[model samples]
Target chain A: MHVKKLRKNTFFSLKGVMLAGIGSLALSAGANAGTVRVTVAEYSAKTGPYFEQVAKDFEAANPGIKIQFEVVPWDNLLQKLTTDISANANADLSIIGTRWLVDFVEQGIAEPLDSYLTPEVKGRFIETFLTPSVMNGKTYGLPIAASARAMYYNKDLFQKAGISEPPKTWAELEANAKKITALGNGVYGFGLQGKEVETDVYFYYGMWSFGGDIVKDGKSGLDSKAAIEAASLYKRLIDEGATQPGVTSYAREDVQNLFKQGKVGMMMTAPFLANQIRDEAPNLKYGVAPIPKGPSGDQGTYGVTDSVIMFQNSKNKAEAFKFLDFLFQPKQRIKFTVNEGFLPVTKAEAEDKYFAENADLKVFTSLLPIARFAPVIAGWEEVADVTTSALQRIYLGNGQIEPTLKDAASKANAILKK
Target chain B: MTAKRVVAPYVLILPSFVLAALIVIWPVNELAQIASHSVNRFGQLRDFVGMANFRALLDDPNFIASLWRTGIWTLGVVGGAIICSVPVALVLNEDFYGRDLARVIVMLPWAVSLTMTAIVWRWALSGESGMLNSALIEFGIIDSNIQWLAEASTAFPMQILIGILVTIPFTVTIILGGLSSIPDDLYEAAALEGAGRWEQFRHITLPLIAPFLNIALVLNTIYVFNSFPIIWAMTQGGPANSTDILVTYLYKVGFRLGKLGEASAVSLVMFGILLIFTLIYVRLTTARGARA
Candidate 1:
């Protein structure tokens, strides 16, 4: 009797579980009609609250249309999207690094927005910022965030080192760094970032100034004479103690921190650092300037953008597009740009006083014309990794510039072939 | 035996067997499938290519270097932890004032998340404005601050040291449990026989705790071999992939480089290596039991 009762109990419990699962599935199916899920990359602490408020306001404006958001960190966004897509359970919309859009489009995971992007809506975006997300004559994504790099210098350090202005050329920068080093009380000049994301971009500032392209005529320009000279110049800076010690240990953030503490004379970074300084080190007087030009007067800066893309598999495409339309409005763009310290992506946002009159943002906007985006190619991340590794080897004095770069070029070429 | 009796054990174990297959076997089989195929960045499978993914990994110099480093990382952490834990466990097992406090302090690190611990270490080991450097300078230990994460030489060793530190608490706990299981009369007998402290440890405590030591060794080797956060949070196996172990390399390949096929292949290799180690360990232990 006891055994029979136990069997009956197990049977009823299993049936109950199945019923509950089916009921939840039915509920989700019903909810899916009006719900649009968006996976947003968390840019800062304010990113979540800002987006949540937007979603609330959007839902209020359009009754019966709910906006659900899954906020992921910047570092884990790609991983999350990959897993989500592989399982065929991705959100209706997502924010991805502009560089990764090529992969998304190649896999047919991104929905082209050309049909929904009317001329009036399209005219709102800066052409330069919008160009990266447009591929094969179709807009697969919209520029949600954009930033360009510029040189930041410590005014106090410059004054103490007997310099009246920021250096205008690499040669002058080196001399100025030496001067700052001489005034050392644990101070360094030319905060060189040798690690982490965009390490290749850091080297590219010099490479471009020396008139080398990342990829010239379908081959890697890493082994070009220009690249070699750039590497050599950076190495000389390290050997002379003009940059921070153990440069391979200092990522972009680390160098920025040193600049914030007023220990570093100069560092080239994104405009976000200006915002960071305002909050974290308000007393540190700083100046923004163009990246130092090469001997021949060539100059370049790295422009980065993150895009919010519509997934091809989205069930609620109309609802998602509606939300996106609301999001790209000047009002929404201004709030996002100001809160995140991103440069203005829309025309109206650019004309706003917060951006138009800002001295630091002026430097960044001026450089956008010469700014270079990461090349749109399959396996670009792999190419960037190769470049970063080769640069690291050069930075650590582990490999010679010529051979190390040559080896890295061949490796990059092989990847580019694929 | 009756037919019902013969089938009862299998019937009783069927549910757990199905669950195990679902959780473990299913995913591994799927991974094997992905490993043998050409997978895109999003893990969509393409043409089947037998042994090609594995061959590609073997050809990559970075992959080979990471494999060997992973071996060193596992051996260093496991060996260091065992050697350090034995003395610590013995000391903690002794009757002393504040023994509970000492044990808690020793075990405190294990209570924190591994990633959190690693992040704290990253800040403390920073080249400039780091707590470690300031403390060293304050003590006049060196004329200048050392860049701990600058290269593989210093960075890798410090990573190993941290791995050992985190592994100690768990290891010492296991060994302490082993120590308590040993009857006090054995030590008493050894002492009566004019055995010194060393002899008591060697003849009585050591042999008795051999099983526990073996267990700790196996578990620690598995944990340390697959450890990701410490190295990742520190150097990210960077400065030219010098400090990279297989797991970090797998992450780079799978996520960073978007080579899912090669990444799956690398994981299978790791699985194979661990499987072999566990098999050999089980064989040795069973053979020793038979011999005794």
Candidate 2:
């Protein structure tokens, strides 16, 4: 009888605990009714504070609607988004790599913004930056950030090497590289990035200059003559010690560090390097120029943009669209672009004195005409991985160049087929 | 037994059983379901495609290479850790000067997070402006700096060394516990019998600690096999993926490549491999123990 009474008491407590849990959950749900949650990717240390301030301002201007921001690192944004989406716990809005926008659209995860967009808001974005996010006659994302690549050369290194001007052609670049390398005290001529993310894009500068496209006529162009020639040129640079020793070890950031330390003569990168150099190494003398031309004089630069997208499953569509409208206003856009050192995506932001008067940004703006955006397709990340690994093999001398390029081309073709 | 007693024990265990089912069994069931179906990159299920995901993994050369490399990584770290820890444990087992401080010093690596350790090592192993390169040059070891993570030949070995380093603290703790459980009288008795130090260690210490050693071996194998941070943070299985093990490959497939179906299949294969290993290892050790 005593044991039975104890069991009865236990059951009552368990029931009471569950009731408390349900009560708290319902209370939290009531509090979350008008919250607009946004997942912002952290580009640098300033990104979080900038977005937090924006959220506070939005909340103050529009009462009864709360704003919540989840700041994520750039490297882990996709993984976080993937898991969040699969678990059905994602935020209402997120910033995503425009290159990955194709997969998002195809999977029906991204909501089309055509219905929400007003003509004035639609006309604010530059066409080149805005076009990458449009699909199936609908705009699914808005370009939040955009950047273009340019060549950065150390002015001190150039003067020491007795070169009066930046190289205009590949041949001259090689000669200048050799001269700079000869002045060695643990110094390298060119800061070649043969490792992580954009390793293939680094090779693409040469491939494009040699008139090769990443994909042509519904197939990979990795095995084309122009690609082969581009690979050979980079290989010769590695062989002749014009680049840093062990090129396979240096990623984009590593090479940038070398450039900042004045240990490397030149490298091709985006305009943010100018911002980094100004802050990290103020005394270092550097100049920005166009990527050197190929033997036939064709040249190209990589243009990249990241987009802010709304999830199709969001319940607070009206509130989210209001926040999006406020985010793209010229005042907010100019502050964000200037703080993060990104090229302006909106016309009003571009006309700001900070962008129009900057000489370094001018070189990037001029190269906009010939810039190539990443091709819009499904499974682009897989294809980029294939190309990066193949380039690594070539850089490490683990495989012969021609056959390796052929093998990679065939592999990329298979992914493209899927 | 009485019905009341049997029923009472089960009732006491019911809550724990439910918790285990919620955390473990449910996820495995989900994975199995996803693995057997054609899934979109976002993990939404499409038509059922039995065994297609597994077959795809079998055909990929990178997957095969990573499988073999996982074997080497597990063996290298676990074997090397046991070998190194035994001696350190034996030394600390002796009542010497500042033994407490010494044990804490040995356990320092375990106090820090594995990812932080790996990141520090990456900076130290960098080709230029790295501490390791600068120290080597200072000591007149080589006239030039070596790019430690530039290729698989050097990078893989260094990674294994790091794995052993981080793994030493746990192994030593287990071995020390085993050593303490050993009675001091045995060594004294052996010494009285004219047995040497090595002989005492061989006959008495080794036999008594065999069970603890087995426990360490099994636990370390499980931990090291699934260890992700050291390799992922250092090389990310790169320089043409020469250093990729199973976990890193799974991350790339599941997250980077966004092939959830194939990634699920890869994880199932990994689970199968580890399960078989643990089962066989436990069986062999228990069988030996029974015989003795």
Candidate 3:
């Protein structure tokens, strides 16, 4: 790998701090270790087993270290976190969504961990996790998991239609969808999330693989042929028999149900669904693929850096660093992430004997090289709003591409400046 | 009793007032302050943009559409709910072999969470595999399964339709309770006047229950207008912003977009609209009562 030269030199290198404090701060939570309470958005009632396992393992290794867990919802996750942080009552540990890292950095809710992490810890994970969380030349958190979206397909449906493999390009994907739909019995050939929020952003990025993007530099990327073509491609599947009829009404769980029930032939979904399908619908044969290439040849898939950052106001940075040390090792990281459906950050962990045995996970692991996150700007949440609204109008059959995309870009650029 | 009431009353209410300040009043004042600024993803309130957030919403085409859509939804769902509920309540109030059973069935939607109800209906109304659409096609009412929640044209109506199911239960119970309070004497007096059932309802029954009906109307209208979960879990105001109401739109701005000020402003607009409608309703109803 090439190390790009810095345009300007900073005298304080992160590498310098790690070596200086390795012994003083490397305190793992043990007999003398302090408890670090953490909060997270709940995934399931079964989450207890995973958390218990992680706590038991970390505690056994670190001696007296412990974890306190509180789970909320995706909708209220940020608000709850902020309320705690705003009140100076934030958790010692937090399992925050990757999308939120930038906003936290801006508010000074997170501590700059450059003063704490060892170079060994930094080198162990995918470099992208650190890059997105880094700002103004400082690292905020060590990521526990990296999530990316992929197209999941039912292998049985494809084989029955005489299709031996999943499509590699947008055109072939559409064509295969049509064939699968032709097989009939009211089966849809494709599924994609049209829900509002970050989920909607993923669908747009998937389309960007064919040459559509919501932003280009400081301008609208959605008005071009690529974006319009991408929009039309989705419309075609809806109009054709390739996708669930009411896909527009689908939330993440709704799509999950359809895919699990053998209703949808192809779907753009999270990597975790692969794990879920194994438990809920193990009889179903499935394969995962990268979001196909568009005319631009730059395929699109969203990666998440599920990171843990210290609240700036916390009075317990010493204990927090101890928790970070116990958390970073892949053994606990893999247990927390894989059970939660997140991909491991380290290449070795992604190819761990456990995840390696899961065929569908192998597909997600394969696509990690091309994964990119949405632009992590403070106003990005607002950009997603404008983009999702515009996409909704397009789907309604009344919206035009150029006007909407231009408006979106203009608004986004202002956000970028802020 | 009145001799020692003054200081005693003040002491009695002090704790309640303190709790109110801690819960409702504090949050409300805080909301007003927060509503004044565009907060970032973190909780810091940004520059004082004044009412620009509210003004921006006025200019937002999507907000305007949601405002109108909410008006239609409130009126349609509340209106349909009353229209269907009153008659059913009246019937269930009458002598019948299975009246108790029917009333129990009517109260079921109220038993389940609105979110749960929306989920169940979404599945039954799903386009291809939905039990409702599939059954309709099976019965030969339509050639193929229609996407009830998928297409733009049908999305709002479908939401209203599902909303009606959950709404009817509440409206019916309110009216039913009102119905039980009405003495049979009013109907007997109307019968002597050669009045039929419709005539009695127009004259005797309605006028007697007008107070209850109006209360039900205001409550249901407000509830339906501000409702978020039903449409969210079902259509999420989607298939192209078709099912968006003021609340979901505000949520999009406030929570999802992290434009808390704009969301709060939108929420204030929603409150303003409801307040106006409520005042108008009270004035009209009271005027009619005075005349009577």
Q: Compared with the true structure, what per-residue lDDT tens digits does model 3 show for residues A203-265?
A: 565566865665666565656677667777776776775777655666556677788999778
C-alpha lDDT of residue A362 in model 3: 72
Query: CA lDDT of A365 in candidate 2?
Result: 93
**Runs with alpha carbons beyond 4 Å of true place in candidate 1:** A1-31, B1-16
Name the fnat for model 3.
Answer: 0.52
**Which of the predicted structures, 1 or 2, would earn the higher TM-score when compared with the native?**
1
Worst 10 residues of 2 chain A by lDDT: A1-10
- Over the stretch A1-418, how does candidate 1's per-residue lDDT look in tens digits? 0001111222232233235334334434544778998888777778889999999999999999999887766666676677667766678999999999999999999999998888999999999999999999999999999999999999999999999999999999999999998887889989999988888989999999999999977899999999999999999999999998999998787888899999899999888888789999999999999999999999999998999999998889989999999999988999999988889999999999999999999999999999999999899999999999999999999999999999999999998888
Give the per-residue lDDT of model 2 (tens digit) for A293-390. Answer: 99898999999999999999988888998999999999899989887888989999989999999999999999999999889978888888999999
Better of 2 and 3 by lDDT: 2
What is the TM-score (0 to 1) of candidate 2?
A: 0.94
All candidates' lDDT scores? 0.89, 0.88, 0.71
lDDT, candidate 2, B132-228, per-residue tens: 9999999999889899999999999999999999999999999999999999998999999999989998999998888888888999999999988
- Cα lDDT, model 2, residue A276: 85
Model 2 chain B: lowest-lDDT 10 consecutive positions? B112-121
Q: For candidate 2, state the interface root-mean-square deviation in angstroms to 1 decimal.
A: 11.4
Report the alpha-carbon TM-score of model 1 versus the true structure. 0.95
Clash totals for all candidate models: 0, 0, 7
Ranking by DockQ: 1, 2, 3
